[model samples]
Structures are given as structure tokens and as C-alpha cells.
Target: MKPSDLDPVVDALEAELRPYRDSHHTYRRLPSGGRDRREILDEMRELASREEAKWRAGYSSGAVYHGSADHIEFLNEVYAVNSQSNPLHPELWPSAVKYEAEVVAMTATMLGGGEEGVPTVCGTVTSGGTESILLAMRTYRDRARAERGVAEPEIVVPVSAHAAFDKAAHYFGMRLVPVPVGADWRADVAAAEDAVTKQTVALVASAPGFPHGVIDPVEELSELARRKGIGCHVDGCLGGFVLPWAERLGYPVPPFDFRLPGVTSMSADTHKFGYAAKGSSVVLYRSSELRRYQYYKTATWMGGLYYSPTFAGSRPGAISAEAWAAMLAFGEEGYTIATKALLETAAVIRAGIERIPELRVLGDPLWVIAFASEEIDVYAVMDQMSARGWNLNGLQHPPAAHICVTLRHAQPGVAQRFVADLEASVADVRHMPGSQGVMAPIYGMTGAVKTRGTVEELLARYGDLQFKA
Candidate 1:
């Protein structure tokens, strides 16, 4: 739809959703007139109860990895214990340093770092996956500018790579060159090699990309970058905590980590699969020299010499402690068992999807699977699922949907419930001839538009809706 057409649709949506939006608590500033603490806590608990079922019952995708009540309680306790600790002042809070350092070390070791006298494979804890990716991209841009004298640096990334890479390119003043994936939904190594030029600073590949959950051919892409004397970044944000354990459980996992000779940096999210509280991830570098480019140090400041390793100065030490506690609590054995259950559950879902004649799985994914329907409109199917209390992710371009299986899905009958709901949804969508569901029009608009500006404007308006009250 054109801009003029979109205004009416948006107005209609706002009118329909205004009641629910008004009651939802987007922020809770200290109760002005002094409400009881117990009352406030109860209100928050009620909100959580309202939002928990979609994720806890395995109807949602990839938001909560380990959603057990006991695990959350333990992590919350860990966070409470270190709530006052600050890593910026190590002298004051030595425990914060210990937690942050150990979190990085453990994450690095999992991702094939510190294997062969690699100087302990140094890194720093960041806010989340986006910061980790941003730091690595900035490091490559700075390294290329200093060593290769490439002023206008560019980074070649697969079309399946995370949006964070594009954000990094925009923030760091580097050109982002996106190469398309092949029919199998993996990055095209030949196209990536063709896209690289003298100005290219790095090549990026995801262990298991977010959109379709297919692992890129990192070995081939990184080797190409190596031959061209540029950096190679392996994005293991979604897979870093699962792939190693999956490989140990006899899954056919590929080489997409520091074990590859061409991989110079990597980003891994502790908050996602590490079962930690949100706001923690690690960014590892092959060498201290390369990581130095990611640091910020200035000596001539009036506030005394200022230097920070990651993006933030005074980071949340509590989240760092929670991440450390999670890693140590769930040792190698704990992770292996969790990964095994997750993959087994995913297999069940995958098999069920394949049995349905209307839909087909995208790729040979382990835990995260994307499926598309050749017979029916997938978005309408997604809408049907949503009506049945399922919150699945919607994909464009090829018009597909995905569900990232977690430990919650491994519960007794969650997988069976998902399959039943999916079958029913497909049948409902098929029966409702020419029904344009809620999200169908939006997805259609996105896929049919030639210029992205219209889509971006719609997204901006969508963002504006969040602040309506």
C-alpha cells in the first residue's frame, strides 16, 4: 500500500488495540504517592504470569531457552547476590572481575578458543549479542584502516547474517555488502568470494543464522577471506552454546568457530542458551593485538585517563555474575543433556512438519527449523496458530515461519501439542478461502514492495505504537 493507504490501516489498528495497550505497563516509575512494596511486586508478578504461558508452554520461538522455574530462581538469586558489584572498580568489587573474566574464559573455551597456546583467547563481557557483533565489526574496520590503509572499508556478509551486522556497518561507517544464500538456504561461498574486493575489511558467516536457522559454509567463506588477507567473523550467537554439545551428541555439526584457521573473531550470546539472565554476551579475538582495536583509551582527558574494553563503561555486574553462575552450575554434562533433549524435540517437530503435504522444512536444521507451505499462504497459517495461543515467528522473502526449539519444548507433551496445533492451523487456513488474516496483509506488502523505504516507514510507525500511552 502507498503512504496514504497505510495511514488508514494504522489508524484502524490503533483503534482496535488501544484498550490493551493502555493497560500494559511499559514502565513503572517509583510509585508517586508510595504504594506498598508488596502491592507493586504483586502487580509485576501478575504481568509475568500473563506473558509466561506462550513461552513456557513452548508455543513461542527462541525467546526463553531454559525456562524452568528452578533455573530462573537460581539465576535471580545469583543476580541479587552481586547486584552491588561493579566491574569498572575492580579494587572495590573483586568479585565482579572474577565473574566477568571467568564468563569470557568459559565461553571462549566452548567456541574453540584457547586450544593451542592461543594466549588464553582473551575477550570481554558485553551487554548482549548486538554489542558483541558490533565490537567485532568495529575491530575489523579499525584493524583494516591501520594495517592495510583501507580508508573506505567494507564488510561482506551473507544475506542470512543477523541485522546486527548491518547496524554495525551503519554505526562504524563501513560499507555492508550482502551476498545471497543458495537454494539450500546456506551462504553462497562463490558469491561471497566474488563480492570481496580490496576495500573489503572482513567476511561474516553465521554458525546458524537467525532467519532460517541454517549454518553457513563458514570454512569455505573464511578460507576465502584468509587468502585475501582480511578478517573473518563467525557469528555463533544462536549456536555457540548448542552446537558444541550437539556435536558431542553425535549430530553432524560443521566447523564454524575459532578452530577454523581463517576465523579471526567470534560473537557468542551467554544470555540466549547459556541459560543466564538477559544482558550478557562475549566477543573473542584471535590475538590481543587485534582486540586492541576494539578498545577505547584516551590519556589527555581532564577526567583522568579513561579506557573501556567493551562498549559500556560501568556494565551490569549482576548479569555478569548470573552468566558465570549459570555456566558453572550447568557444567559440560548439564549442557550436553540439555542439548540432547532440545535436538530430540526439534527432530519430532521436523518430522511432523514433513508429514504435512502442504508444508516443507527449509533445511536440515538441528534445533531451529523454518518451514514453508507450497499449498497455502504461510502467514495465514501463522495467524491461525496465533489464534490457538501459539506465537511463532514469521519470515519473508520466501514467506516461511520458524520455531526455535528449547528445553521448554522438550517437556512431556509440548512437541505433540505443537504438532497437533500446527495440523489444525493448516486445516483451518485451508478451509477459510480467500481470508486475509491480521498479519497476512503486512507480510504481503513487505514481500511485494520493490522499494524498502515503504516497509521501513511502516516499521517506524509500528515502533511509534509502543509509545502511544
Candidate 2:
């Protein structure tokens, strides 16, 4: 359905998204006179406190990766200390450079940099996973244009790859050729091989893709890229930090990093599983020469000679500092311990979902688990879960929902509680098949509508509503 056709639905959603409109003041304009500092602080605290319980109690998926109070307080203290510092002026705050360089080096080492058969994996810190992927794609596009004389570059991505690749293609003016996935939810290497053409500049793989949380065949895909003489970028934004420790703790993690000969670059998010605050990610390249393409320098500009790495010019050095502090605070031992708990909890949740006869898991995932019900509308089940305060990621094509297990979900009894609630949600869906909820009908309408532009318009309208005071 068109967005205008769903005005009532959007109105209902706006109420849920912006519930504080009734109780709190809407500030379309700044006050003529400044309010009391204490009053402002009290209002902010009240808003935060109201939303804290659901995530803290593991009712959400992937949003609050590490919500421990002490950890949060420590990060907040670190951010406050370096709040005014910006990486752009390195002379003023050389500590920002130190933090970012060390953050890159530490992340590189974790992802098999400076190891056997791998070139010096160097990279810059990006705002987040999307920025990281964008930079990587832009780097390949520029390099292909400069060296290979490829005027029109293309990227071969798995159907299950993150949408950031599509965003990268859109932003950087590159063609994205999508290949299908197999029954196991991993990328189809044969189809990827068939999709590669002379214009193809790079191939994309994912370490535990977001939808089904299954790693693509990086070994084979990267090998194909090597044979085809193209770059292979592994989207490890979701699983990079956790997988190394998971492999160390004896899990079945495939080789998806610089260890593979064909792997040219990678994107890993410190914010996701590294227990760092949001807004920081690392994009690594096989060598410095390839990474140099990602930099922007202008000596003939009206302003003084300047060079900026990554997309943003004056980035939050505080975020890099927080990422560095988070890594140091949670040393290898701490991360391993945390990954152990997360994977164990995920295993329990997976097994619980499997035991339910009505539903079946999409893949053999280690942490992020996706499940679908064959007997009932999975979206309705999602709404039922939402009614019980659970927030899950809804997927299309197969109509599934996933709960990305985080440190919060590893808390005592959270896994069991999730399983019980899930079973109850499935039962509710069975009892009332005709009853519809807010999100289910939206998903249903979006799927039924064949015109993609109409759905795009619907999403645009929702985005517009978010800014409606």
C-alpha cells in the first residue's frame, strides 16, 4: 500500500515512537530565556530513565550490546574528559591520534593483521559500519578507475549482505550485482562467480550476515576474487570482535579475515561486540597503498593545504578514546569470557526455539539467531512478542525475525525468559490468527505491494514523522 493509504497506521506508530509529546515540552524553537540547568538535567534524566528498563532487562535485540551500568559509567566518564577534543586538530590533541592509531592497530591484530601471508592490514577509524563500508567501496572504485581503467565499476555482493553495500553503491556511483544464497543462508559462491564481469571491481562477503547470522563462504569467495583479480571485502561489522574470541574458545568460525589470501579489506565495528560506545568502526585494507585511495587531500584549495581521512572532517575523538578505553578495559581475557557467555546464551535460545515444533531456525548461527514459523504468520508472532516487550529484527523474503544476542541478553535468566516468552508468543499467534498488530500489517502491506517505489515512499513518510515534534 502507498504511504498515504496507510496514514492511520503511521499515526498510530507516531504515537508509539513519540509518546513523550504529551508529557514533555516540544522545543521547535529555543527558549527566549535559558532554563535552569538543574531543570534541564532533571528532564533529560526522566526521559532516559523511562526507556532504560526494557533494554536493560534484555527486551531488545542488538541495540544495547553492553549495557552494564559500571561499564557505561566508565565510558561516560571517559567521553566527558575528551568531549572537547577533535581529531582534526592533531597538534592540539595528539592524544586523539594516539588513541585512533592504537585502536586501528589493536583491531588489525585481532583480525589477523601482521600475520603469516597477510600484508600489513592498515585502516582508518570510521563513524560506524556504514561509513566503513562506504569508504572501502569508494576506495575500490577509485583504485579501479585509476589502475584498471574500469570506467564503470561494479561490486558482487551476496543477497544477504548488509544494505550498507547498497548505500555505498548509491553514494559512490558504483553498480551492485547481487548473488543469491544457498539453503544454508550463506552466499552462493558459484552464483557469485557467474555474477562477476569485467566491470566487477570487488566481491563482498559477510562474517555472520545480519539476516540469518550465517557466515558467507569467505574462503571460496575470496579465492574467486583472487582468481578474477578483484578486491574481496569481508563485512565483519557484526561479528569481527566476537568471532576471533569465539574461534579461540573453540567455535566453528570460518576464515573470513585478512588470513585468507584473497581477502583484501574488512569492516569491523568496535561498538557492536567490542563493548565500546556507539559511533566507531574500523575498516582495514590489505596494505597502505590500497588505503591511500580512501584519503582526500587538497593542496590547491582556497583554504590552507588540508587532508582528511574517512568521511567526516572533525570527528569525535572522544568516541575513539572510548573505543580504545573499552578495548583496554576488556582485555583479551575479558572479551573471551564475555563471548563465552553470549554464545552460551545464544545456544540456549536457539535450542529453545528449535524445540518448538511450530518454528524452525534459518541457519546454524552462533549468536544472532533468526527463526520463522511455517504454520503461522511470522510477522504476527513478532507482534505478539512485541506485545510482551520484546523488540526483534524483522526480515523479508522468508519472513523471519531475529534476536541479536548481546551482553545484556547474557544476564542471568534472560535467555530462559526469552525462550518462555517466545513460546508463549507462538501460542498466542496460534490462538488468534486473525488479530493484527501494528508492525505485522505494515510488513504484510509492504510485502504485498510489488512496486518498490511505493514502499520507499512509505519509509520516507515514516522518516518524516520521526522529525514531527
Candidate 3:
């Protein structure tokens, strides 16, 4: 009925989120004078050491893709050299331009950009995947309005597409026509075909979408868009860097990039599989004309004439430097080898989940694997896994849990440990029926509640709690 009614769950969440609140000093206000740099560094290192162990030991899902110590040190050095640089002021930081340009060019080439017969692909690096998707959607919206004289624009997307598309639709005043996925967990092409309308500006596809880690029917969906004379956007934020390598390693990766004539735009995260730092992603278009719509320029301002690309006028150039360095460091061979190991590790995990009688792997996934149970609460199983120090992603719609395999999982015994712990967690959940865990009841409540406004209030209260000093 109210957020207070869920006090027990909220309390547990607070304890987990605010572990350092009581142990560490809360910086409610700045001191009159700055503290010693060494003392500040010591405090920061203490926090970093505590948090780093979780992902370093392969306990997290998709957080640290390439967490090798040497690689991190390299990126840190690169970041340090360019820490003062901003891409917004290219005249002052020409190196930033070079870094960003190389990063985009490398990513585009990897995603079928410069191949013969394909259109010239161009793009800009952004803060992250959300911004990339936002830019692409805005590009489509503006392009449609300018070329087709369409005032109201729409996007036909599978329900499994990333929530960023929904966010873009909400932010840009466009409509998202939802289509259902088939039993294979791929987008239903027929449903998408039917969902398209005269006002539809684009169709959305995913190369291994987030929830179930299954690639959508991109060829069919893109062909449909081609026939309808609309743009098709393939969301590869999670899979872009990994999929090409996986394909070269002989995995069954589908065509889902610029090679598809109808796939006019794409968003890929350098932070995810490209092994860049946390703040970089690339949003690409088939032509410079389409990408120009994502830019902003105005000469009427009080200040000097201003023009900017992507959402932010000023962004850290160090991040782009890190991305460029990471790409060059890995190269094609390094990525192929890494992807092979990742997929192999994922295969082991997927096979282990299949062995567990209570659980079933949701879809045909390569690395990011989701599993669900028809016998018991998957959230309870997830909580049990949490008890064993495993951090996985919880999924709704059909009540599933996932562990996105990173390079950390390819370590010596991580995959084996995952399967063994998962089996033990399922057994624990089965033995203690109705022993609802902290997250299980919360998810149950969220799913059962018809009034979403109550859920939004609960989420807002949770957010407020996060800002508590």
C-alpha cells in the first residue's frame, strides 16, 4: 500500500548499498582546508580495494570485462596523461580529436563499416550506451521529419529491445510500437511487420538483447525495414565488440551491423567488451547526413558561435584516449582469442544450468546467459546465489536470473564454481519452500501490484535513500 509497508526489504537494501556509511567518515560538507593528498588517496584506495575483490574474483555479472591488472594500469596511465583534456575544445586538445576519431573509426571497421559495397559509416563517441541510443533515435526522428514531412514519428521495436529505446521515445515525444518475441525468444518478424505504420520512422533490433541474451531476427527485421523504406537500428551495446570476434571464432553470429542495408544506425559500448573505461560508447550512422541530425549548433547565443556533437558539449577526453588505447592493445587477434574463451566458459555454464533439474536456460545464448525455473522461485535461487557471494542480474517478464560472462569468468575455476554454487542454491531454495529472501518478496510485490504509481513512489523513495549523507 505504501513504501513504509516494505520497510523490512528497504532496510535490507540500505544495509547492502550503504555498507561504508557507518565504517567510513561521511563527507557531508567540505573541510575549511583540503586534506593531505596521501591521506585522501589512502581512503580512496581502501574503498577501491574492498570493492575490487568482488569483480576480480569473477563474482559479478558483466561489470569488469577485462580486469587484468596490467591492462588496468595501462588504461590508468593513458587516463592520467590526458586527464586535463576535453574533447569539446578540440583547438586546445587536438590529441582528443585524434583519439576519438580513431576510436570511432576502429569500432566502425569492426562492425562492418569500411567493407566494400557498404555505405560510408560515420559516428561520434558518447558518454555511454544510453546516450548512444538517444542520439540514434533523435537522428531517426529528425531525419523523418525533414525528409518525409512526418510530424509524428514512431519506432517499431520488439518488447525485448533495450529500455533505452523506450527512454528515447519518452524523451523525444515519439511512439514505440511494441511487438512480441516468438517462443525461441527472438523477435517475431510477422508481429513487427504488422506493427509498422505510415508514421513509423525506424525499426529496432538487438544483437543479443539484454534480458535473455538472444540475438533478435535482425536480417528479417532489417529486410522488413528496407522494404518499408524506414531506418533499422541494431542495438549492439552489449554484443557489438564481442559478436564480431565470436563470428571470426566460428560462432553462429548473425548479420546485424552496417552490412545490412536497412540497418542505418547502431550503438555500441566501448566500455563493455572493448575494455575501455566506464565513460565511452559509439553511436554510428550509415551516412554523415544522418549523423548530422545528432549534432547541435547555434550562432545566436550571447557567447561565441557554439556547435556540439552528442548530448554533452564538454566531455572527458581521457575516456576516448582509454578507448583508443584499449582497441589498439587488443587488436583483432586478441579479441578473437578472448571471445573464444568467453564463449567456451559460457557454454560450460549453460550446460551446467541444463543439468540442474529445477532450472532451464532461457534462450540460445553465447556469453550472457539467463536461466529460469518452472519449479520454484528463481529470485529465491538468485538470493541463495547471492548468499554464496555471486552477483547476477535478475530478470522479470518470466522470472529469470542471468550471469553475463566476462573475461573474469574465463579464469581457472570460475565457471565450475558458478555451476556448483548454482546447483547448491537451487537445492537450498527447494528445501526451504516459501522461505522468501530479501529480493524475492520485493520482485513478487512489484510483479503483482497493478498500480505502477505505487512502485514508482517506492523506487523514488529508494533513490532518495541513496542520496542520504
Candidate 4:
């Protein structure tokens, strides 16, 4: 599209992103006096009432992993009890220490750790999956510098890995080598082997990538890592909580954790499928010796002896408490049940997509489902799905769309409605003549924009519009 085409497309997006601007009061400056507590609560509640139903009724994809009212209320209670707690000062609140320690232990145990006389897997709780990935990458970089005397460190990551790996490479000033996946959308082991060099400190494989929902050949990748004497980090941020239960339920989940000799570290999100509240994740290392590199300490500081395990100095202990509480509430039995419902729902949705003559499923993904079509415009179909209140994700590269099936979709009638609405969406897009949706032109022009600076500028401008207040 021309520059003129992008302007109107951006204007429409700005309108949708700022829907609350006209309805609510914008606080550009402080008022002389504070508002009443009840009035503020009522106003926030009113907005939540208008917005909660989309995810509540399973119209969304992956935004709300476990949206049960009772679970949310339980997490809220846990957060409330530890609202004043901060993990930075363990002396002030010993319970915060226990919460974080147990959270890490439980997560590690779930992912092939916490056994007697094992390699002694240990880790620290981070803000989220992004921070976990960043911390692990930085730790490996620093470890290489100290132990191997390699000043210039690099990490080999699959192209289908999460964007956080790119962010980690940028922020840590390390080289990132992207290896393309095979036809099945999983990482190609031979290509990854070629990408590694003497300077390579770590290798990354996603346990079910974000875009295509295909797990890489981690067994082979980890074996390669073992031979090359480098660390292997499995990004289980998406499938960490669900895959173990899925395997127990008879899904063919490959080994992607510390059980393998080459697997040195991993990251998992408690906020996603662990049913915990947002803002909690675990990054585990094979041993406390390796994890020690991730910590920061300085006795010479004027601010007194300081040490922070993760990125943030004063972290929210309440979120860690919520994660711990959530894990205990949903033990093995609860997770197995939730996994059953979620997988069953996902199978239905995937089959429904396969039944559509125009659409083609990307891979043999278990939960997250991506489908594309050579017959019709996929973004147009996504637009129609959006019109029907179906919130799905749009993919690039091959131009596809996916839905991360969660407990939200396990609700009664949601799976059936999604299939019915998707069939209608494809039909509507098939009959429609020209590209005429908000995303249609945007995606079309973005795919055509080969200039990196132009694409960055366009995205930056769109993000700026989101903050117009």
C-alpha cells in the first residue's frame, strides 16, 4: 500500500485502542484533592464490567489462560494477604522468601528437577517469561566471559523462538544466530548445528514455539549442545505447565527439560497455564553453581550490602505468593483435569479448522492451532472473526492466524461457537471481493515493506497513537 493507505488504517486502529479515552477521565495532571475511594473503585469496576466478558466467555485467545471466577478470587486473596511484602528484604518478611523458594522448587520439580541426589536444579523467580529469558541469556553470557575467557559471546536460537530472545540479545550486547525451522515448523537440527561456533555460549529451543505451536527437536539440539560443551536453554514459557500433564494424558511430548544431560536451563511462565496471576515465572538452572552467575552482589555499595537475584531489586512478593498459592490449589489432579478439558477443546477446534476446505492447519500442534489458506485472504478472515467477537492472533511470514487454546475455550459452547463462527468468517471473507478490513491493508503493506527502518517507524507511530490519552 501507499503512504496514503497507511494513514487511514492507523486512524482506525487508534480509535479502537483508545476507546476508554472518551469514556473515562484522563489523569494528565494531579487534582488538588484526591477522589473518594468508593467512587474510584466504582469507576474501575464499571470499566472492567464492560471489558471482562470477552475473555470470560472464551472469545479471546491466550490472554486469560485460566479464567475461572473462583480461581481468580483465590489468587486475589493470596495477593491481598501479601500486598505489603517485598522480596528484596527477606528479613522483613520471611514468608516472602518461602513463597518464592517454594514457587521455584515446585516449578523445577514439575520440569524434571527437585529429586534427591540429582544435579540440584535451582533458580530465582523473575517478573515474567521475558525477564526469565533475559536473565538466563545474560547469565550464560556472563558465565562465558568469566569461565571461558570469551569476550564476544553468542547464542543460537531457532527462528520460531519467542521475541524475548531477540530482546535479550539486543539488551545484553550479544550476537544471536537465528536458525530456520524445517518444513514441519520445528527447528532444523542440522542448521542449528551449523550456526554454533566456538564463541557460542548457549543454544535455545522452544517447547512449542509461539507462532506455529511446534516443539523443536530438543532431544537432538540438547545432544548437540552436550557434544559442543555449551548450555542448552529450553523455552517452555508456553507449554511448561501443560506439557507434563499432556504427556501424562498420553500426548507425545519430547524431552525438553533438565532430565536430559545437555539441558542446563529452562524458563516457564506461571502466569500462563499455571493458573497463577500475571507477573510471575521461573528460570531454572541445572545447579546452584550455574544459577549463582545470575545474581548481583556488592558489599562496597554506599547503599549498604546489596544483592538482587533477578532484574528487579524490589520485586512484588504478592505475585510470588499468588503463584505459590495457585500451585498448591491446583495440584497434580487439578492440572490433569484442566489439561484434559483444554486439550479436548483444542482438538475440536483444530479438527474444525481442518474441516474447512479453504484453510490448512500449519502443523500437528496439540493446543495452539494455526491455520492458513491459499484460497482466500487470511487477514480478511481474521477481520471477520474479529467482527464476530473472536479474538485470534495474526501471524506473519507465511501470513497465518492462530488461537492458543486455554481453559477459557473449555467453557461450554465456546468450542462449538468458535468453529461455527470461524466457518462463517471464512465464508464471509470468501464472498467479499476486495481487501477492506483494518488489518487487511496493514498486514498487506507490512509484508511488502522490505525496508527495516520504514517498518519500525510505522510500528512506532502506531504505538505512539496508543498513548494519546
Cα lDDT of model 3 by residue, 9-99, tens digit: 6788789789998899888899889999999999999999999999999999998999999999999999999999998899999999999
Considering every candidate listed, which one attains the maximal lDDT?
2
Alpha-carbon local distance difference test for all models? 0.87, 0.91, 0.90, 0.89
lDDT: worst 10-residue window of model 4: 441-450
lDDT for residue 15 in candidate 3, whole number 0-100: 91
Question: Which residue pairs collide, candidate 4?
Answer: none
Candidate 2 lowest-lDDT run of ten:
441-450
What is residue 363's positional error in candidate 1, in angstroms? 1.7
Q: lDDT for model 2, please.
A: 0.91
Candidate 2 residue pairs in clash (backbone atoms < 3 Å)? none
Question: How far off is model 2, as Cα RMSD?
Answer: 1.3
Q: Taking the tens digit of each residue's C-alpha lDDT, what string does model 2 give over 1-469? A: 5546667777877888899988888999989999999999999999999999999999998998999999999999999999999999999999999999999988898988964345489899999999999999999999999999999899999999999999999988899999999999999999999999999999999998999999999999999999999999999999999999999999998898988889999999999998899999999999999999999999998989999998898899999999999999998999999999999999999999999999999988999999987798888888889899999998888888899999899999999999999999999989997655767756645334447777677678789998887
Q: After superposition, how far is residue 26 of candidate 2 from its true place, in Å?
A: 0.6
Per-residue lDDT tens digits for candidate 4, residues 237-314, read 999999989999998888877888899999999999998999999999999989999999999989998999988989
* Ranking 1 against 3 by lDDT, winner: 3
lDDT of 1 by residue, 331-379 (tens): 9999999999999999999999988889999977888899998889898
At residue 239, give the lDDT of candidate 1.
95
Error of 2 at 267 (Å): 0.5
Candidate 2 TM-score over all chains jointly: 0.98
**Order the candidates by lDDT, highest first — what do you get?**
2, 3, 4, 1
